[model samples]
Target: MKPVDSPERTKNRTRSGRRGGESTTRTDILTAARHLFGENGFTKTSMRSIATEAGVDVALVSYHFGSKRGLFTAVMEVPGDPISRVTAAASGPRSDLGRRLITTFTSIWENDDMGVALQAMLRSAVNDDGAAKAFGDFASGEMMPALAKTAGLSQETVRAIGSCVFGLALMRYLIRAESFTSLTVDELVDQFGPKIQAIVDQGR
Candidate 1:
């Protein structure tokens, strides 16, 4: 007869599997949320739909994210926290602020899988008042203040800089304008860096 497995070994194996599966389950929910939100926009996509897409019970979605708004916030938060990244980049030497900001922003879009979710949020903001308000509030309340504090600029100036950078990214990546898309990241940065720097200089 085969030897019986030890109770302690079985217990440890069960705990490990449970921990691993919980992480996997959370990841699945997030992946499903991103895809659905990207395709359907915020108003059209429901928590139940996300649950269905993730193949988890609807209650689990609530357990993980609290609500749809909470989930949307989590989705919009790119890995490494885009706001913190920008603040850190701006915290460097004042002379290099433009180059740093542009370089960091471009690198983020190029390296991360956030483009789709960003596009979705932009689209939703355009069409939905609620989404527009939420997006604007987040930018004004959270991002602009942090960036302005670090960069030593007025919130208005930082907001304008953010708009310019966002427009560039939208044209280059989301809209895929041929001319913008054709340029390398360095080339685009070189071209835009002066304009951004000019704005940063004004804040001094």
Candidate 2:
């Protein structure tokens, strides 16, 4: 007869194998998600693939992230290029900062990956309060600080500009409002630039 492994040894083997500790398993899922999403994009990547890459059960992925949208939102917490892009826009002539910022934002949203990311974020935020807070924190922590430091802007001005950006993003990108869609990017910059400038002036 085959020798039976002790119960303690069997338990140790289970923990040491692909099924890691709880926190370790959570981190593995996120790591797997980032790699797959970056390589395959959101639509092509699935929960099963992510779990497979992480060497965990699909149910564990669900237990941690709740859903694919939730996982995407969680993945977004890993830093992205938006902060760098914002820094570039802000680190420019103070006079036309508004136009630069608007231009930068519009261009970003136009990218396919970013557009999908926005959809995931908006959809996930609908029911999950933590998802909404993550976005708010990213805006306040990364985007706001970059603008405030590079452009000599106050928190209030940055907040107002952020509001305008988010509002336009929601209406133009997410909601697909015809009124917003009717305008070209140049037209958007033309119309919104001065408004942002006025806010920037106030914060000075």
Q: Residues 1-204, candidate 2, lDDT per residue (tens digit)?
A: 999999999998887776557999999999998777656656567899999999989999999988776786578753245666788999878989988888888877776877677666766555566555555655666568888999998888888999998899888877889999899988999998888988987786
Q: Which lDDT tens digits does candidate 1 get at residues 9-108?
A: 8888877752357678888888888777666566677899999998889999899888776776787654445566768888988888888889888877
What local lDDT score does residue 161 receive in model 2, on the 0 to 100 scale?
93
Going through the candidates in the order shown, the clash numbers are 0, 0
lDDT of each: 0.78, 0.80
What residue pairs clash in candidate 2, if any at all? none
RMSD of 2: 10.1
- The local lDDT score (0 to 100) that residue 103 gets in candidate 1 is 86
Q: Which candidate is the best by TM-score?
A: 2
Report the Cα lDDT for residue 174, model 1: 67
TM-score of each: 0.63, 0.66
